[model samples]
Structures are given as structure tokens and as C-alpha cells.
Target: MIILFRIRRWLFKYIYHLIIILSLPLISLFSYNHLLNNHYHPKLINYTTLNQLYINNNTLFDNLFHSNKITSKFPISERSFSSLNDDVFQYGCRDPIMESSKNKRLNAAFVVLARNTEIDGVILSMRSLERRFNQWFNYPWIFLNDEPFNDEFKSRVEEVSSGEINFGLINSLNWHFPNNLENSPFFNEVVENQGDRGIMYGNMKSYHNMCRFYSGFFFEHPLIKDLEFYWRVEPDVEFYCDLTYDPFLEMKKNNKKYGFTITIKELINTVPNLFKLTNKFIIENNIKLPDTWSLFSNNMKFFKGENEINYKDVKNLDDFFRNLIKNTKYNYAKNVINNNNSDNDKQIPSKLLSKLNKLIINHSNSLPKSINEKFNDESYNLCHFWSNFEIASNELFTSPQYKAYYKFLEDSNGFFTERWGDAPIHSLAAGMFLNLSEIHYFRDIGYKHSTIGHCPYNSPNQLPYIPSDKFKHQVLPQDEIYMSEIDPPIKNPLINSNLGASGCRCRCPSDHREVENSGGSCSSLWLKLNDNNFPNSNSLTNHQLNLDLIENWALNSLMDWINNNGNIDDWEISQSERDLLSKNVI
Candidate 1:
């Protein structure tokens, strides 16, 4: 009886192996035919139709990624698998290194500010931009550095790119520390105070030089002067979508002067003196002030039924303001924030107001008195466009108005005596000089640098059916969503906030935590899909069938599939096709 049972087990195992071997070719043919016919219904999609759809979907992904709705470990599910199909097509096509379009009208290039040590990061950013957007347009790229780029850095970048490339060195004059101040008491005090504050690069003279150069000198560089527009790219940044349309052309058509993807409040400590300096500039240059400027002034006359200040006193206010800041501690107001525990107690008190009155600026009695409240207002020095990703008219930076504005600030010596970031400097230039119509928020472009990312939350199609755990540290801000006719009302962030909380290190808000012991769809799906030792109870023949199918699809082309199957459309995608692609078989 034992001999008979052993013989029977051996026979079963052998038959299973034979069946898997016999079915491999048939499975491959089926998967090939399914992928070819599934979405290739001419009426539904072709390369042209899919290209436009991919662009729109890519924009949605931008918003999704930025909001941290997706993360590095996130996996594509059945629903999202189709959305990412363009990426597969791009890989399979081995598309030619596209030549610049002969009829391309806009003269634009990507400008990179980087160091030689950052070559690897720069290459990665370049590859992403090329794969996502620039490959088709073939826009030139200009690399700028304080020091000359080495031969190796130039060669690597050139090899990866087909576009015209130019490398330039930052002029020393633009990078020079403010002169005649080596022994100045105030300058030394500023440096010492900054070092004590623990601000990143606060004590570094090179960082200050870089900030000042970018503020007033980059667009003036000889390499960029001939171009009408530029897209500022940096090392290690990511571009996450297929940019089917030309953004430079979009800027030209719409008459856009500046475009940015992210805007956040700047650290108040970095620019304590910036607002005062700006006021002085307005007075010296006789620059027309925007209505929002009233937000900074305490004059009741500007408000109906409020008292007005003496016009003469306000005009001669520069010296008084200078004296106040000179007497004030560096970043004094910001330090007060850390000393105080309650946000509601943030109003500038009577003593501070009395002094500020002499300077013609007062936050007391303002509609929103605290930094957190009026953060988006131009009067608030804390508001700024994140400048890492910028698309703008070259004229915006080189125009006479901007030059005069920058010169006025430079003369104040704020760049060295105080830490002023280029982000706020660029933000102020756009906010103060350009009309609202000329400034654009490019929510369509997906961008990531460091920890923060953003995507437009407008289209329902833009969001995944399943939320990603990427926003584990910070809950997605609901207010950022822009509802459209087609977009579904935004999902409640709280729903997914707690899905995997037990493992998350972040101290997120309590309301945002996942329900105890309950794993939501995103977390559950992530485990099932990503675990290398995923539990499987399938027969050997079925496993072999899936492996063969995926292998045939990736190595073969759509043409090969179509040749085998003949003309067909609207066929259902096979289970193997969906699983294989989502599992990274292709």
C-alpha cells in the first residue's frame, strides 16, 4: 500500500510540471492578445488620444504626489494600473532621442544652479525631467555655478541630454561679500547671532552670496540673457508626470511673468528687517504701492472711521525705522514666538506699537494681527513663493523695476547683516511688481524636493480611489483642493489618517489616526501587493502561466501582439496582464 501511494504522488507531481510546460506558449499568446486589444479600441484610445489622457492624469498625479497622497513605497492597484500605462509604453518604445521641433516658437531653457559635488543628483533630476517632459521639446539646459563645472560633470550631463547645453561661472562681483564692512561691529554681531540661532547655513558667507546672486544677478548672466524665459531646476528635484504640452508656450500665450508650484510661509526670523527695507525702497524709488500695502500700515484713515497719520511724518519715516531695527535684537520678533506658549497672545503689544508707529508700519489692530493669520498677505514678510521650481519671463528678473528694487535692498546691507533667503526676495518681486494676472500658480506640474510635494486636488480623476500613506507625517491640507465640475467633493483626510498609525513615527494629530486594529484598503492592499513572501495558494501551472504571460508582453511589442491576434478591440484585460504589470513584471 505504501509503494502504491508513493507512485501515485510522483505521478501527480510529474503531470503538473508537464502541464505547466505545455501551457506556457498558449498563456503568452493570450496575454499578448489581451494587452493589445484591451485598451486599444480605436474609438476609445490610440497613441494620440492616450497621450492627452496621460497628460491630464499626470497632472492629477502631480497634485496627489505633492499632497503626500502617494509615497515611495506605494503600490499601484487594479484601478491605478491603467493610469500608469504611459510609463510602460514609454519604456517599451525606446523612443528616439527627440530632436528640437523646427517650428517651436518659444526660446526657453532649463537653468540649473548646482555645485560640481552634486553631479549625480543633477543627473537624476535631468533624467526625470527628460522622461517626464523635456525629451519631446528638446529645450536647451544652462548650468550655472559659483565655480566652474569640471570636465566630468559637463560630459555626464551632455551624454544624457540631446539639447543644447551651456555652462557658465557666476561672476565674482555678484558673489562678493558686502565691502567696507569687514570690521564693522554690526556685521560681526549679525554673524554671531545667526550662528547661535541654529539656522541652516546662517553663518555661511557662501550661502548669503548665493542668495544675493540669485536675487539680482542670475537672469543678468550672459548665458541666459538671450533667452526670453527659463524654468529653474535644481539637483535631486523630481518631475513626476508626462508633460505633453509646452509650459513655456503656455506662459507666452497667457502672458505669464512668473509661475510657481508651491507657496509656504517663510521663517519670520530670516527676514525681520526685510519689510522695513522694502518700505524704504518704495519711498526712495517712488514705486506705486498695491492696495494690500494698507495691511501693514496702522493708519485709521485708510480704514473708514480710523485716524490717519501725518503724511510728512510717514514720508520721513526711513531713519526712524532704521534706528528701531538697529536697536532691536536680530530676529527679535521671531524669538518672541518661541518664548510665548499661546498663539492667541501673538499680537504686538502697546509698547511695541508705540515704537512701530514712528516707522509707519503696525500689525496691531490689523484685520489679522498674527503671523499665522496674515501669512499670505504681501504686507506679511513671512509669505513667499517656494523658488526651487520657477518658470518666468527673463524680463521679470532683468527688468529695470526689479533691478532698482534689488539695488535698494542691497544698499540696506540686509543680505549680510541679516539672513534673507532668495525665496522671499523672488516672491516680493513678483508680488509687488507684477500684476495678479501675470503671476500664475502651476498646480499642474508635479514636483518633489526634500520632504514636501504637491499636486492639484481639483479633479476627482486626479485622486486615487485608495489614498497612499505618503502623508504620514503631515495630513493633506484639505483647503488646497480646488473643486471642479468633474471632480468629486474632496475625501475626508481623517478617513485614511489612522490606517497604519501603529507603525508610523510621526506625531500626527489625534483625529488623523487610523481606527485601532482596523487596517484600511490602502494599508491592506499595500501589504498584499508589496510583500515579497506574499501568501499564495495557487497551483504550479497557474504560477507558470502568469510568469510566461508577463515575460512575453514586455519583450514583445504591440505590433507583434497585433500580428498574432489580428484586428480586435474592447477585449477584457486578463487577470495575468493586470497583476503582472502592477507587480513590476514590465
Candidate 2:
């Protein structure tokens, strides 16, 4: 039995990896005809050239291995544990007067989509989180689906959670796209030409935007406001920590508003002079910048690009922002520009100040959207948006911020239509503007929900469904039920007393504890059935089967699922055939 189990596990591992790497579309072209739906009667032999895309090929085993990278042990020093009080990371130090702690740990829930096989790891990670922070969680749980949360999925999830797990019914109207909008010119052109190459390109663009727009603005919607931190748990993700700390407070205290696990450059050309524009704004508003805002350093030295661009010249967006920090007006340095000697570099002065001002003036005169102060309004800071990781606040999603970030970057996609993702865009924005103290890496602490071990913890060997005794520390409610009421929001420190801004960790840690840490879905099978995930004949058939289930004309959740669910079976059509079918169906 042991040998058989090991064999089964190995088989599952390789098979799953191969499937993702080779792709269902490729599999169908080579082998899966038997899985095709019966009614795919096509009138013509659809064949078109697939514009093959070449990416920096990441391998199957490496991809899988990367998922296991979080640390299993905390990296704190002996001095850390001995000198620091728990109050820094924990909810309270027992300050009896101000109620010690507000005691408002969220009854946070997760909404994950799954299909094919049962996903067991995600729930297990959550169980671990509850056990380590039971005293902090004061809320319920919710699970949703594009399909019914089968008894198997629900029971298994609840069993591991050790808490009430409520399953939500995704109304079809809320789940799928309505078959109207054929009247609107833009959307109509999108629909009518979908069968032509015209539609596939557009749908792909629109679908990508759907995720980006949501990541950028989901907080304003009524659906998730009650929950303070919605830790997005996707299928096949991992976690590894006791999580004795509360991230929400970290976000609150240091004003490390937006939290992300990974950072990457923005698509070039999306916002070319983004940096120059920011400098313009700062100078105009006379906002006090970090002290290190100087461009050059040393005894008459030559830094590359020092003659033209004040900061070191760079080819990638990451380097550009990395250089921006020195010119930032509010850092560890207080002297705006103190080189004890006379400097005559024109480029140096611009990068330090003038270039950014130029962008501000140009943008101010160019667009209305860029002019709105609400563009920087704090109300929209989504406390739980994730790109490669979680972003806690609205600290990085400003228009001018994005505009200033793309100076050295260019959109990979030539048209620039499907270029910047919210994650990359915001990362650049924060990189150029955020103070290092304002960014909490939680290196010593960790979390469990990110992919490739970008989180704070270790990946458990058990399935996502297993709620082992290791997770016993979590506190659970007796009733496997949830109240239909929304949770009261955790108070916003920046909004209440501060003027749309939270104080930074600008100073040093008062306690040693403040020093210890850092660390740290598909629902669908909840997606609507789209043929592209299947091979040609099979995909054609599933399209007809799912036709009647459509609903919600605007934020059509079905359209999203069809576009994203990794059924892979959909991408099997010959490039031309896929285009024709995608255009007509989507």
C-alpha cells in the first residue's frame, strides 16, 4: 500500500505538470479526441496560423519546485525573542486602558474555484493560519463556485477548516455573460467580429483588463468591503508559518499600505515619462521628499549615465525605480542635494527635479482623468489586491505614479493594449515613491497563500484538503454556518484621524519586537465553459452545451471564467479554427 501510494503521488505530480507545460490544446492535437464532446459538428475545416509567442521558457519541474520555497523556520535572532515583546506583532501587549486591542480579528473567508481533481492544499494552509492566529480571527468563511459546491468539496473543506464554511450560490446572472450588448457599437463590433481574427484579439485584451481593473479597483464594490483582508487563495498554492503576527496592523502602523510578494517591471511605453511627471508634482506641491534625493555622490566620480540621467542609467524598469530612491525627497538623507562642490550636469538636475516637473505640466495640460485629485484618493486602496503577492493599501495605484514609473520601461506588446498589469504597474509606482521603511518585507515572518514560495511559510506535503493536527491551534465555531451579514470594516487609521495618509515607520523601532519579523483561485472550475480550453472538436461541442447558462450582461462572470479557467482543453483548436470559434462564441 505504501509503494502504491507513492506511485500514485508521483503519477499525479508528473501528469499535472506535463499537462500544464505541454498544454491541453497541444494534447488534443496529439491525443485527446476521445474526450471531445459529441455535438461539435463543424461545416468547414477551420485552420489559421497561431501567432506563437516565445517566452523565457520556465520548465515544468522548476515551476513545481519553485512553489516549495518558503522557509519552514523563523529567522529571528536570540536577541529578538528575548528582548522584544509580543505586542509588536501580536494584537496587544495588554494595555488595559484602550481595551488593549480592539480585538477585531477578521472572520476572514476565502473564495476559490476548482475543477478536475479535488484541491486539498489551500484549505490546509488556511487551517494552519487559523491555528496560529485563532485569537485574532473573529469572523466566518465563504466558498463560492461557478458550479455547485459539491458535497464532496464542501464537506472536505469544512472538515479541514474546523470551522463553519458557507457555500455561496453564484446566480447564473451573476456568473455568466448575457447574450445582449449586440447594440453597443464598441462591444457589438467586439462580438460580431469575434469569429474573425478581429474578436479573439479584442476578447483577450478585454479579459486581461477585467482582472487588472478588478485588482486595481475591487474595494469600491459592495461584495467584499465587509472583510478587511481577503487573502486570495488560488488552486495549487502553498503556505508555511505559525503566523503569530497580524499583517493588518503592520499595514496600519508603518503605512506599508500595499503588500505584494513579488515585484517586476512595467511594460515599456505604457507611461514613458512617469518619473518626470512625479518630480513635477512634488516640486509644485512642495511635498517634503526624503533627504537622499541627490543624483550624484563621491569625489568627482563618473557614474554611468550621470552626465545625462542623474541617477545610474538602466535598461529595465526595476533599475529605473531603484535609482529613483536616491532622488526621493523623503528618505534617510536630509540634504536635498549636497555635493560640497559645484556641479554643472544638466541631465543631473533634470533627473533630480526638472524632468519630473515637465511630465506633470504636460500631463496636466493633456488629460482630464489625470487631473482628478480623486485619482489619489485613499478610499480605493484595495487592502487585498495581489499580483505576484498581496498589496494591502492604495499606496501605489496613482495615475501620476504609474505615469512617472515608465521612463525607462516599455510595453512588451507593441500595440501597448495588453501591456501593463496592475501588479507590475503598482510595483513600479511604489518602487519609485515608497520609502524603504514604508515597505514591510516580513522576512522573518511568513504566509501560506502565495505561489512558488513567494509567501512566508513552507509548503506542506499533505493535500490541500487535509486539516492535520498540526493545525489544531486554530479556534473554530460550533456551527458549520455563516451569518449573512457583512463584517464591520477594520478602522482605517489614515482616514479617521490622519488626512488620507498613514504615518510611516520614518523613525526607528521603539521595541525589539518591531524588529523581529517579516516573513512572509480559480473557482472554477467556476468558470463558464469556453471551447478554447478544449481541443477543436471537443471545444466546439462544450460551447453549445454551455450556451443556455448565461447571465449578468455587464460584469459577466462567465465571460471571465471562459477566458481564464485553466481547463486547457480549450486551447487545442488549430490557430485559425480557434480564432473563428473564439470570435463567434465569446
Candidate 3:
């Protein structure tokens, strides 16, 4: 009996040990799944649970993956998901159902500015837009060129376009340099210098003419003068997704004046005096700046320590104005003030002189604020909407305020001297004249110009796989070669549709981070400054919203770190690291 008891006890003990060993993998899988679910589906998990999970496992995963790099770079407190508000993520069509129902076609057209040589590129753009959105609405397309369109270009574009097409020649007065400066030696020298410096398209006089024309005169073209809205289309550019609804109508219904897919920082050298000139205009006109104007200004204190002047002190105020006027970049304004006919022969407008005097008087007592605060410094963040893919109301450009503003800049001859781009010109005008609510970010539109592009992904919980068979052999007629070369076979057919709604039949990869989430984009900053009047229509739950907010914050922090500490080109991921990242849900 004693021998039997000893054997049984030994067997029971060993069996229990064996059971625990066998169950370890199952326990591990459960734990991993729990963490992942919390990570991706913040909506499903409570805030307290997510915070606890982040606190415990963030350190453990630090070495496991570089995905944690963003969180690791910033302090845990600043990036904690718990600190973000639920409302920050709310944007876009405030009342989707209501807006969706009012589908009356807007009085809009796709305006393409191209040369005759760009027939093939124009057809590609026309066909893509037709297939994606214009076929259903049949919005007219108005084509304008510096010269008359040839028969071949017209025929090919009409053949591919779904809507009525009209071709027009740009007026010589509008397309060429102003008569006063056409042959000026100073103007010629500036153009030559710009080319020598390798500024983008600065060497090309036609490019400068194009920028100047678009900045001030395109909206008034005879072909499109009566039209209320226009979607600027460029040759060789692409629209990557199927737009299910009419964007023009959407803009009209929502009272949005401007819509864009990308916002980037403009090259500072291209517009050395743009901000200074813009600030001068703002103060002179006493224009009511938008609340979002703060995004453009760093709000750096102009005077520090003992140098700060009391607003009531007359001597101090005179000294400040004298320094400011002497330091100002508007030499044209100075010439007019000094009555230097040698520099500029035209008399300064009485209205302008009065406004200039008012500017000095108004700002004498105190330092200029808002757009005016950084007058002597590089105040502009250089953020601009890429005007190449703009959908905007014609009235925005044609408005009297804008026309005056453009004239002011044009008279300064900055277009020839500094190579001012239309993108920044349009952006600054939009920033000054329109409220944040008037601007719209087309998150759904996947657009590419030159080498840069924006591709939006599906939401996290949606269908994660894009069926490869759907796009395998599909190619637009005549676009087969270009399509094939640009879009290769999808190696990873997986996508997360639960994150956001991509356009219907979008062939582009839907798994990449959006431009708005990247460091280079100013869209997030734009949204952050959005007016609170818009209603919340985002369907994302609180936790899901928090996840997006956290991700954007982290990515921005990472980019800022890269810009300050190291070269972005030097920051690269290895194939192994990519593979590891691919295996895990980001």
C-alpha cells in the first residue's frame, strides 16, 4: 500500500507540471491579442485600460520594434493617449446625410491650363477625372493656353473627356509681363539671377508669366468668367481613386470656398518678401485677420529686456517706427513715400498713401500684432496649399480685396525678382480673407503631382484585404503603358478599410499614412485651427479618435526631431525592419 501511494503522488505532481508547460503558448497568444486589440481598436477598450496597457508594455516593446520610436522620442506624458480630446478628430461633412441628399449639380468646370504639346498628358488627366467623378455630373472643361489650342490637342482631349469642352486663348495682356516692366533692364537681370541660383522654373520667363497670371487673372478668363467654381487640373497629374460623390456640389452645399488635398511648406528662397509684403497689405487695409492667422505667426516677442518700449512714450515710439520703416522690404513703398521717380515713375495712389500713413499712426503706440507681429522677422511658416490641385470658388480670386492684394504684390515686381509661386500667393490670400470654416481638406481625394502624392487608407476595423483580382488586368484605354509603369502589381494586397472611407474602386494602396498625418503637411495645423461652429460628424468612437490623435502627434514629434537633430535622408529602415513592421498592425 505504501509503495503504491508513493508512485501515485509522484505521477500527479509531474502531470500538473506538464499541463502548465503545454498551456503557455495559449496564454501568451491571449495576452498578445489583448494588447493588439487595445492598440488598434481603442474604441473597444476603455481609456483606463488603454493607459494601463501603454504604461506596462510600452517599455517592453521599445526594443521589440521601431514602431515605438515615436513614443520613445517624446516624453510619455505629452504623448499619452489619455490627454487628447475626443472632439479634435471630428471634421468633414458635418451632416453627411443631409449634404449627400442635396445633389444639385454645381455650376463648376475643370479648368486645365496646358500647352499644345501636352495633349497626351491632358487626355490622361481628363480620362482619369471622367472615370472617377465627371462622367456622372458631366461638368464642362474649359481649356486655356497662352497660344491657341491646335486641332490635334482639342480633338484628343474631347475624345477622352465626358463633358462639354471649350478652348480659349489667354489674353496677351494677362499672360505677358506688365507693359511697364516688359523690357526693364532690372527685371531682366533679376530673371537671369534667379535662373543662376537654380530656383525652380525661375529661368523660364513663361513659368513666371504663368505664376503671375494664375495669381491675379485666371479667374477672369472670358471662357470661365461666368462660372462660379473651378477645379484646376494640370497635365500629367493623376487622380487615383473613384470619387463616388460630386465634390463641386459638396463644396457648394457646405459653403466651402477652397478645397485641397495637399498642403506643404513653400521654399523660403522662392518668396523672400512675400510675408513681409502680405503683412504690409494687411495692416494698411486694416483687414480683419482670421483667428487662424496665428498659425502663420510664431508670436515671438519683438523686444526683450531693456529694449522693450512703453506704448505711451512718444520718443520710443518714433524710434521704433524709424527702425521699422528703415528695415522694411517694400522698397517700392519707400520710393513712393520719398517721391523717388528714378526707382518707380508712377505716382502712389492717394488711397494707398492714406492707408500707409494710417498704418504708421495705428501701430505707433504698440507693436503690430497678428500677421504684423513678425514683420521684421521671418514670420511665415511657409505653409501653402499646393494650388496645382485646387477646387475653389471663382469669386475667391475675383473678389475686390484679392485683386487689390495681387496688384500690390505685382507692383512690387516680386513675380519677376523673387519667383513668387501661385501656391503661396493663393494660400496667403485664403488665410487672410477666409475663415477656417471656408477651407476644406479633401481627405478622400488621392492626388499626385510630380513626385509627391497623398494616398489615404481605409479605417482600422474595415475589410483589411484588397482583392488583387479586381485590378489585375484593368487599365484605361490609351493609358495602359503609363498606368502599367506607374502602378505595379500589388505585393501586399492587405488594407484596413475600417479606418476611413476611401473612394469607391480606389486602386491605390490604402494602407499608407495620410499626408495630413505626416510631418511635412500643414493640414493638421489647419484642422487644429478650425472654427468650433461646425458640427461633429466623425463616426469614430472616443478611443478610436484618440488613437488617431496620438499617432499624428507622435509622427509629427518624430519629424521635428529628425529636422532638428539629423538628416531625414539618413533615417532609413532596413528590409528586415520593414518585414517585421508589416507583420504587425500599425
Candidate 4:
């Protein structure tokens, strides 16, 4: 009886083993389908956990083999999962050195103007550039400081950077009071007495040196001389989106000479006589250049007697029109006004003259305010391209016109005595020498310095803090055709062309108008994602897309709301966790 019982147990064990082996393929099939179907989606967990499951720990053979039931609501498919392989990922990230063909293309590098004290902030900026744009480009970085970079600063920056890193000391001559000004009593007195002038950086000798270097010598630095294009990066600036294509390549292909992310009006006090100096330089140098509107030439022959032509002094509308054509200082100005006129000035109709007189009188008073009343033809309040973030062709600086312009400004000693910012200087040069077509506004770039900031995401779903003056800060003309705002979710054309166009259809039933009408902040953003007509709505279309990011952003919003509304402890919390926090131990 005992032997029979042992036989029965052995038979039962054999049957159980056989059944388990037979079900193995079925279990694998079910799990494979579950992964393929994207059913096991996690709702609200920290991004660390999500990244671990999604990005890092990709291999899960044990879990797949043991569990017969389908799990995992994550939307990842086989294609998405496999693409994260180191080789695939790195190749897609655009390492220019690896692609032999790109080497023969444009010579470009990132130029960082900073001091040794700003090394930490510089590293952060570099890391952001690498992750967003430069990793693929593998563009070299040139660091310039008025003072020599310390070893620690050099090593730390090198460690975080993937591309070639170069450190350069500003020429002592470039960073000090010029030989002409060093012995001047006036310069010394102004530097000493201007400390309390309330002008930003007006009194700092070092600041003057910094501005002078950028204006006259940054592009000429030996480390930067070979590159045809340089993207100026500042310490602590952030890049908000992924850049798939090479911006340098775009600039080269499109013949873009000057690119700026932000443009703001310079303080009037900072560049009080900048326009007078610029006009004098243009006139004295005999420089003539073509721009978007008309040819700007140092040829003052156009307005030789403009100030003397008193329109109000004319006796009648017919007399005003007659004198305007005959006594005008510039033939070009007269032709522009009288092209529609009849051949006989004597027979000019009263009706036409009345209209012409009104137009002249109205526009005469409404003309743009000029820095110098004598040079009212050229208005200058120092609207400049912020040099803090700029990308430009080397020719913009290296050309004869630009070189002469810089030399003229350098000789005047305005940089030392007044707080002349490099931004205004660069902007004025570009505006005068380069065509509007050559000047591009990088509206998509996320830029911030000190108190000001800008993001391309017009309605950001996830920014931690929004600048109060974001909408008010006028970087470009409101109606500028080329500088139009591209709504979020669409891959910035400046970043990627195909990715944005391939995004999903808007899933929202209501349009952007409806979303705006809703009037709630988060709700409006959410509805914008759903509005199909809205650009980049596909950025949020996928069910499992960026879920962790969204959740984290939502949590941040909740915390902010709670903080702004009342005490943090007002929210539901376990008594044990609170007690542990109060005692500093469990």
C-alpha cells in the first residue's frame, strides 16, 4: 500500500510538471501581447520610478516569464522600447564628429563669455545645450574671461562637456583702460565720481572691459577665429526643447548673418550719444549699405537742407507741395513724395494739395524721436539685439564695415566714460550693415537672465514659474511676419521640421477659442492640447505620452496653489509621518 501511494505521488508530480511546461508558451504569448497592447499604464507615481521602468531597467525576463496574466498599462511599443539602445540613442543625438559628411559643412562653435566666478552657472548652461542641441552637433565651446580661468573651473567644465573645450584669457589690453585713457584725468575722475550715478554698470571698470571685449575682440579671439559661426551662450541660461537639426547648418544654408533670441530696448542713459556717434561714423567713413527699406548711406547729401525746409512756413497747400519738390534736399525723398504728382506743379489741384499738406503735418510731428535733434533723420533709442544670446556669421564682425564701425566706436572712449552696452552696439551694426532678411529672431529659444525670461511655449503646461512680464516684454515687432509665435506641442521649426508636422491630430472637440473662453489657466492649456486647429496639439495626444512629466507638473501646481492659498499642513497627511517629521526621527 505504501509503494502504491509513492507511485501515485510520483505520477501526480509528473502530471503537474508537464502541465506547467505546456502552459509556458501561452504565458509568454499573453505577456507579449500585453506589452504590445500597452495596457499596463501607471497613473501617478514619481518620475524616478517611471524613468526606471521605462528608460533604465528595460530587461524584465523574470517578470514576463513568471506572470501569466497581462499587466502594464504603459503605452510603449516594441519600436519605442528598442530605440533607446545606447548605439541607436547616441547616433540619433547628432555627434558631428561621427558624421564625416557634416565636417565639411559650416565651421561653428559655441562662444561663452564668462568669469571664473561664474563657472558653476556656465556648466549648467553647457549641460542644457548639450542635452538639447549641441550633443548632436558636438560643437566646440570657447570660454573667455578677463582674468585667467582657474584650474578647478577648467576641469569641472571639461568634465561635464562632451565636445572640445577651450579656455582663453581676455587680452590684458582689451580688458584695461586703453593706453590713451589710462593717464587721462577726466576718465579717472568720471570712473570715481560715477559710482552713485544709478546707471547699471556705469562705474565698474571691469564691466567696461567686458563690454569692450565683446564689441571689439570676442570674434577676433584666436580660439574663435577659425569658426564661421558662433552661438553666444551665457552662464545659467536654459534651453527648453530638443533641437534635432543643426542650427548652424540652417544659418549657413539660409544665409542668416545675425540671429538673436531676445531683443530689448537699451537704457537711454546707457547709450546717450550712441546714435550721434553711429551717424558720425557712418558719415565720416563714407559707408553705404542696403537694408530692407532703402539704401542707408553716409551720404548726408539727401538731407543737406532738411532742417531748413520749414513746412509750416509755406503760405498754402499748393505752395507747400511746390516747394517740397523743388527745394527738397534729397532727390530720392522728393521723388518718393512727387511720383504721383502731375507734370505741372503750377496747375496742382487744391484738393490734392490740401490732402498732401495734412499728411505732411500729421507725420511731421509723429516721426520717430531722434537721439540728436540735429540728426532727426535717424532715430535711436538703442533698440539692440541682446548680445547675451546671439548666433551669427563671423563675417558680421570680421567684415571691413563692421571692423571699421567697431574701431570708430572704440576710439571715442564712450565705453569707458558711459555705460555703453555691447548689445546696442551689435544691434546697431546689424541694423545698418546687414539686411533684415539676414537678421533672424529665435523666438523658440528659451532664454532667461537675471529678472527677465522667455519660453516659446506660449501657454506652458509645465513651467515652474512664469515671468510676470513675459507677455509685456516686446522682443520683436508685434506684427512681424517672420517672427510669428508657433503654439506649443508643435516641434519648433527651428528645432525639428518633420517631428512637429507628424504630431497627432488635436483630440479636443472645442477649438482654441473655446479653450480661451474657459478662462481657467490649466483648463485652457488642456483644451489647447485638444484643439486640432491649434498647432502642436499632438504634443499631448498620446494616452501614455509624458504621463510622468504631466503628473509631476500637476503636483507642482497643487503645491503652489496650496502654498499660495494657506498653510502646507492643511492638506491631508498621515499622523505618523507628521509625528516623525516633528521629532526628526521615526
Compared with the true structure, the alpha-carbon lDDT of candidate 2 equals 0.33
Worst 10 residues of 2 by lDDT: 522-531
Per-candidate Cα lDDT values, in order, are 0.52, 0.33, 0.60, 0.52
Model 2 residue 79 CA deviation (Å) reads 15
Clashing pairs counted in every model? 9, 69, 9, 12
| Full ranking by TM-score | 3, 4, 1, 2
Q: In lDDT terms, which candidate is top?
A: 3
Candidate 1 segments exceeding 4 Å error: 1-105, 178-189, 290-381, 457-586
Query: Which sections of candidate 3 miss by over 4 Å?
Result: 1-102, 302-373, 376-378, 459-497, 509-514, 531-586
TM-scores for candidates 1 onward, in order:
0.51, 0.36, 0.60, 0.51
lDDT of 1 by residue, 92-133 (tens): 111222213434748889999999999999987887676555
Candidate 3, residue 54: the lDDT equals 36
Expressed as tens digits, the lDDT of each residue in 119-175 for candidate 4 is: 878877876676555554567788888788899999888766656888888788867
lDDT string, candidate 2, 72-179, tens digits: 121211111111111123311222112214545443444443431544654554554454333233234555454676666776666556445666544443333333
The local lDDT score (0 to 100) that residue 285 gets in candidate 3 is: 94
lDDT of 3 at 39: 17
Alpha-carbon shift of residue 526 in model 4 (angstroms): 31
